[model samples]
Target chain A: MEYRRSLLEVRDLHVEVEGKEVIRGLDLVLHRGEKLALMGPNGSGKSSLSMALMGHPGYKIKRGAIVLDGNDITGLSPDRRAKVGLFLAMQNPVVVQGLSVTNFLRAILKAKRGEEVPIREFREMLVKAMGLLEMERSFAARYVNDGFSGGEKKKLELLQMTLLNPKVAVVDEIDSGLDVDALKIVAEGINRVASEESAFLLITHYRRILDYIRPDGVAVLMEGRIVASGGPELINQIDRQGYDWLAVKTA
Target chain B: MNVPTPPLELAQEPEELKNIRRKAWNVYTQAPFPDRASTLWRFSSPEAFWIIPENISSMLERGKITYKLEAPNGLLLSDLQQAVSDESVPVGALVGPEFGKFEALNLALWERGAYLRIPERAKIDQPVVLRKHVSGEGLVLDRSLIHVAREASLTIVEVLEGELTGNGNGYLNAVKEVLVEEGAALTLVEIDLTRGTTRAFVTARHSIGSNAELKWVLARFGEGVLKANLGACLSGQGAKSEISGAVFGFGQGKSDIHTFHDHVEKRTFSNIVLRVVLQDRARSAYTGLIRIGTNASYSEAFQENQNLLLSGDVRAESIPELEILTDEVQCKHGVTVGPVEEELLFYLMSRGVPREDAVRLLVAGFLEPVLGHIPGDFREPLDGRVAHSIKPATEVENVL
Candidate 1:
């Protein structure tokens, strides 16, 4: 049997925001098309780790390195990193007024792809992605994330993932503000992307999203470090028992 | 370039109207030009004031005036001469003979103007567009009288544009008088996109009757200096007026807009919303006042001004004043001046948009709500101008 090689490796990563360190010494490895569910309690630095991986300007990588496909992208700008096949779905999406959804999506896609896609091809892909995420057709004309409901925002994030088709995705808290139906739709979209080509670092506090997108592995995050990593059974233990056992083990 | 001397020839008016012009000329000569100490001119620079040029004949030699009128059957649209000569016209009803320095200068030096009178109960479906262009480097004085009769409805859109003819300085002084009778409505949009080192003084004095409504939108994007003053008197009960303005300054441009709302009777309502965006070394100031008279009970007035400073060199000031003398009145004013939110920029950049593109998007978004208040036809052009104004500043290669 052939084995796929690793696409992304986070080695002993330490990150800070506004001079305060939040993510301390973390390591993770993922191959192409693999999905890893990152579970942790509140303030466990799950979102910060995702941001630091995506090269968010607010995050200061004090130590360690982010290697993507044998290249260290730790010092790359956010846009440069995105062009090199990285995507981040923010936990709290910011609203950009006057920029329509279609225009923003097309611009980012152009920046990532290094060329403008034909209008017909772009529209087709956008329409298909919106359909997959259960977003209304009229949403294309609305401003980016402006006055959007929580579920709609998550759906937009998923739609972006489908259109961009990045090599690696760090989705932060995609299931927190979503209803059951929306959660299922979002999960399905992520799963489809993972199955196609992209590897995902799914950040979530609850295990509900795992029901739809079956993770190949589960990693328990506590105090900015991965306390334990195992197969899918770790989620079952987490669901029945909770994070207390993992906390005790880490302590 | 010789400056223009005032007291130009009158275009054949009645004796009474001619006397009014003479009085206005006297006022123009007697009153001193506004200095920095004046309350109305505090934020405005004294050096930017241009005297009325003496080259009136040169201005007439260049045939740069263009007027077009499209109205319903009952509406009367003609030149100012015909309207003032007609017996039924009220010559000095809305704007008095001598209102201010600019008004006096406009009435005295103005040779021709547009006269629009909508008959009682008549409704004009499409807006009447009045576009003016000034080509030469002298003073161009113009005036307009708009009267929406009882129960009538009308919309007038005025666009003033001109180029600097000789030494890169053009002067345009305009006065607009509007009267909305009982149950009538009027919507006026004034867009100034004149280029060059021009100075524009545009003032609109309007009076609203009982149950009447007035919607005014002003967008000042001239390349030079501008002072725009708008005043509305809610003279009758239930009179309402809403005024929205979008002002942009770039490079060395300077713009100031002053608005006043007077609630003279009971149950009157007025709202003022103005947004200014500046970059580079440009400067802009906005002053708004809402006054509720003693008899204006149950009246409501709101004023809000927001300014977006895209660069550190840009300057903006917003001052909202309110005076309430009556009980049971709702009056409030708000002012905000700041740069774009960094978090919003960070969010857009994370989506693969470059830093410049993100700043451009944020600026557009910042002015979206104000631009939305204008007509849909203006959305594209105004947005384009707004985009161009901030292009240079946002194009910096440094993304940090």
Candidate 2:
């Protein structure tokens, strides 16, 4: 028998934000084209784990090694890590005043593509992508998420995900504040970006999002560690028995 | 050109004009220069403008003025000497000596000026450009008098450039007075991109008539010290004014801007937005006031000043004040002075944008409220100047 190494491997992760430990000794493995649903009760450090993997400044890695595609990316800056193909769909998108959506998207695309796109082509691509998210054409003219509603913010993050086309994406609570229609649209958008060449880690607390986009694996994150991992049946069991069963089993 | 001495008297000038200049000079000489103790001059270095009357006169003489008219039909454009001599143009009614000390000095010794008069009910759709250049180390006093008659409309653009020779410094003091008659409209754009260690002082006073409208846009990207005093008086019913300005200060430059919106009549409206970006050791300060008089009922006034500091050593101060004596009027002022938020920076960085470029984007966005308000023709040039001003701070060879 032969074993295949995972595309992303988190080994003995211990993360802290502002000198307080949040994610303690967590380990997870994800393969290319795999959708891993990270589920847990509130305060289980699911978001912290995702942020730690992305090398957020506020989340200090006390002890961890995040290997991406056989390269150690634990010490890279957030921007460098992004250039290396890591993307995080933040739960609450930041409202950047004064920067238009078009300019911001063009800049990020330019930085990633390593060349400036012609104005006409850039505008065309932006309009097309905005259309996919059902956003108004005028949304590109407004400041970056300056006055967007909660669902609109989520759609914006998803819009960037499709445009940037990262190799590995960690979507943190992408469906938390979204309505049912927005949730389906966002899930469809996520599915549009997820291809055979990329991997996804969907960090969520609710089970509704899983209904739209089927997950290949389900992992229960309890007390800062992956206490259980299984097929889609695990989601049903957790839905029926709640996370208490997993907590008691871990204890 | 040799530096001229103070108390310059033109023998051929009219007695009334001569008497006005003499009175202005007397007032300018007797009034002491503004000191730091004065609340208005606290953020600026008062000694930066300390000079004798002869030096001020000399600086005013070195500035050259050119008047370019895109629509020469229904407008009268002339130099100060000719405009004052012509009986048809009422120069005295446009500018007066009671404005301030800077106005006094400028009105008394201005060597070069442009007077523009638009005929009643005529609309000059094209922009009238006024190019004023100061060469060598001297004083420059340039005056602009604009009169838009009843139901008329005009657009004016003023560009001030200074090129200092050798190691000498130049001082440019300018005054612009605009009168928008009943049902008239006026749009004025002022761009200051002077180089060297020259000092610039611009005082602009506008009077809006009944049912008239005024829009003023200012861009400041000079290297030295800049002091701008802009005021608008909504003296007639249904008058409206919108003033917007963007300033980018880099290196060791300092910029101080003061704006006032005086609503004196019923149903008047005014809005002011000013944006300032400071990098390196530069500093900028903005003081805005909105005054609603007793009879200015149903008036609406809004003032906003936002400042962005790119470096730790840079400083930005915003002060917004309001005095309302009338009821049923709406007036609000907002001031924000801070550096770029860490969350915004991190959000951009997370999307593969380098730190330096992220900062640049944030700074550019900080000025958009004012930059977007600029007329389309002037927006690109002003945007380019702002980008050039912050180039040094944003240049990065490599980011880890």
Candidate 3:
């Protein structure tokens, strides 16, 4: 059997927001080409963990190191982390008034590649990505996330993820507000981007998305720490018995 | 310094204009400096713009003033001084010396001026471009009078560029009066590109006739200190006016802007939108007013001012006021002053954009709406100016 190197490792991570610790002593790892489902109930530090991994200034890492591909990114800025191939699809994307989608996508691509992409080439890439997400061509001209529907915002996130093709992508609640059809499209986007050189950590409160993008491993997070980790059957077990059983076991 | 006597060169003007200049000079010498306690002068000191009498004479003698005007046939475009001597232009029909002290000084000391007239019932598809360039030190005054005849339509773009040389600071006072006749439509764009040891005070007033329309755009990207007063009077029934301004302040720049919209007739409409971006210790103060007269029933008026502070050292103050004397009128005003939202910055930075580029993108987006109101040809150059004004984050530290 071939050896698969771990792409992302979170060791003893402690995160505090506004001086209140939200993520405490959490450890997780994902190997290359692995899809990990991080299941947690509401306010279980799922979003905080994603934010901390992305180096959000507001999410303070009191005591932890986020290693990506053997590089310690604990002290990296958000832009630096992004440049190093760490992508975080925020749950509620902010509205940047007057910034067109086309300009933003081009800017991000240039920032990542460290060079300007020709206008025509960028347009082709944008069209392809938007088409894959089932987005209309007019979406290119619309301001970023301004007056966007929940489904449209999610689609935009997926479009960005597809364009960046990062080594590790933490998709936070990408399927929460999406309908079944939209979920299918999002799942297909993730599946197409999945490769041996990349990994995905899908953070969600429900296992509905796990049905489409079958996870190789499932981890249940409770009270700022992982309580259980198992194979795909653990998802069916949690679905049948609920998280109470896991919470009881952890206690 | 005490008030200086009127210049002796007023004696060289024609009888009619000489009288006007003398009267304006008298007003200029007699009017006391603006009180800092007054609302109009509270944020800015009038002393910064005050010019000594001796410097005014030297400026009149040594200043270099050149202008180019392009207009279609049947339109009258000529030197304002010559037009005044020919008695072909009304000197103070819309605005007079009594309008203010700085206005009086401009009327008395202006050596370079232009007069433009669009003939009645004539429609010019292409815009008339007016370029005025001034280079020198001391006090430079330029005046412009634009009249749109009844049923005529015209668009005028006035570009003001200047460079001040020598060790002493330069003072510039420019006054413009625009008249839109009944049933006429006029679009006026004023671009200010003055830099280097310059103190510019500009005042522009517009009078709209019955059923007339006025579109006014003001773009300010100048260094040093600037005090501008822009006013619009919707005097006739169904008169409409839209005034939009974009100001970018950087590198120790200071700008004080005041706008007034007066709805004087029934069913008249007016709207004003002003956006200011300040960085690197630059400061800006904006006060806008919308007034609806008691007799102007059913009139509508709106005013908005938004300020974006890019650095911690930068300061911005915005005040939008409305006085509606009639119950049937619709009047609204909004004002906002704040630094760039941190969340918005994080959202952009998370996409791999550096902090400086993120700030630039956000500032560009913040100013996009107002810049959208500008013409394409004029907007491109202003974009360059805006980019220049937004310095890197390293230089402007503590940027949120």
Candidate 4:
């Protein structure tokens, strides 16, 4: 595929973690302001693609190109990738103690942007984000996702995403552990972030989330490769027919 | 940070340390300094022998000691000296031929309070917490006293934290006494996390009144040779006591916890559980005794100790003893010592977690029975300290 002025472009990317290849020459492009949904079954390497792009330690780039904007980020560390406008909403975030959620977001924002926001501005941003996610104000004072329920943890990730606005966001399986009300609030939060200037690659196994947050494009990933790409209607087809449709079409 | 300290040279507490110093030295000299013939030093490393009382007062100059009160009532928080003056308290420092090692303590005991009196029908949910911190080096002598009124409930949490790392020798001699009035409930939780060439001596005793209750938890971690003794006396009818402890000893550290619970009252109850995890060349020992007197009829008492040995060289010994001078007491005792189950480690490794990661989590969760018992406020710091204290199963590369 020809690369346009896309925010993120993964071209023929093959990745391996600890000598085991998980992503084989996968190719996909997330344009600026576009919402691309990557749907795949378990072990289909949906998370690997995001982890590889975010530069997780275990994943090795066997062959391919991961060009963010115009700079190649194939060799960058996860933190560095994060600094350069790349964000990954982890499936299961690491629990860190002695660090409050508010503190973590501020540090992450400062590190990623290379500058710290004033206390008032930070608090204002926090107030707004909490309101948008319907989160209790007291939640900010607690440790980062420490002893949090499944719904609370998912909401926390969305809270981080809302505060630190990135050029490209790769949300991996955000819909897995959310309740109906929480899913709606999270979708509203994600929809507010999605615009013409910011690109989002939302990876989900279920299609129920597609109802709340409309996608500009949809892609099917099977056997570590994108098998199909089409307009918004593809989500409905998958929802009605399931992954079995993708299997038949791919075959 | 490197301000010059007054060359206080800890040499046996000096004359300024006064009476307590004189008695501790006398006991130190007669104790023979844990040598070859002694059973106490049989499993402990010999290098720990150099940790003498030589210059203990000097510790006041090198380390930082800051304390925070547990909460609203402020009660007795840190400053060990203030604890003695708050009430006329006894530190059990009597010079005697039978217990000659504590001769110095009698001289140092502050005679303000005789007992912790909990007024009858006083209901309390707030816990009394004390934090003791030390940095740099030297010798530290700490003490505290607690009294509960009748029907009053209280919890005491003591956290001893050490910061920075250097070559140094330090000794901590801390003693605490608790007096429970009739119809009172007293709970005590102690966390001792100190590393380096340090030696810690902790002595504590609890006295229970009629229909009063006592609960005590002692969790010891980090790298050091620690001698801990906490005991309780049920001196009145219908008094109750429950004791439990967990110790994680690794590297060249040594830990020995000896508890003596006396059931001297009628219809009293008692229970005890002690667990130890030994790694590297470290050594751990748990000795406990439950003595039921002749008049203590219709009473219940139990004691048990378990040990997990990570390596062959790391040895663990347990002795659970019972003295029943009465025929109408319900009592039992048991002891277990062994290595970590290979099947548990294999089960964890089968998942995505690496062997080191798996082992770390296993050891952590293995001790969770005790860790989980701790209240939430101090849980994180305690876990972090334990994670660091248990000899970090995984070594990090100094890439930075």
lDDT of 1 by residue, B1-400 (tens): 2223646555557777777777777766667676677556888764454453454456545534555665545455588866777655665566655677667767766767888877899887877777777666666677888888999887887777666455644666778888999999998887777776677777788999999999998887645878877899999999999998877787688888889999999999999988888877789988888999999999999998988887788889877888899899998889899877777766776678777777777777777666666667756777777766666444233444
Which residue segments of model 2 deviate by more than 4 Å?
A1-5, B1-6, B56-76, B88-95, B124-126, B165-168, B391-400
Q: Which stretches of candidate 4 lie over 4 Å from their true place?
A: A1-4, A17-19, A94-99, A113-121, A245-251, B1-170, B183-198, B208-227, B230-400
Q: Considering DockQ, which of the candidate structures 2 and 3 is the better prediction for this target?
A: 3
Each prediction's whole-model lDDT (CA):
0.80, 0.81, 0.85, 0.69
Off by over 4 Å in 3: B1-14, B70-76, B394-400
Candidate 4, CAPRI quality class derived from DockQ:
incorrect
The alpha-carbon deviation from the true structure for residue B53 of candidate 3, after best TM-score superposition, in angstroms, is 3.0
* Best first by TM-score, ranked: 3, 2, 1, 4
The full ranking of all candidates by lDDT, starting with the best, is: 3, 2, 1, 4
Collision count for each candidate, in order: 7, 6, 0, 25
Model 2 chain A lowest lDDT segment of ten: A1-10
Error of 3 at A103 (Å): 1.6
What alpha-carbon RMSD in Å does predicted model 2 have with respect to the real structure? 3.2
- Per-model DockQ: 0.62, 0.63, 0.64, 0.02
Compare candidates 2 and 3 on TM-score and give the better one.
Answer: 3
TM-score (C-alpha) between model 4 and the true structure: 0.63
Give all TM-scores, in the order shown: 0.92, 0.93, 0.94, 0.63
Give candidate 1 regions above 4 Å deviation: A110-123, B1-6, B9-11, B50-64, B70-77, B165-168, B392-399
| Candidate 4 structure quality by residue, lDDT tens digits, B286-371 | 77878899889889999888787777778778777788888788998888787655434332222222345435555665566566
Candidate 2 chain B: minimum summed lDDT over ten consecutive residues — where? B391-400
The TM-score of predicted model 3 comes to: 0.94
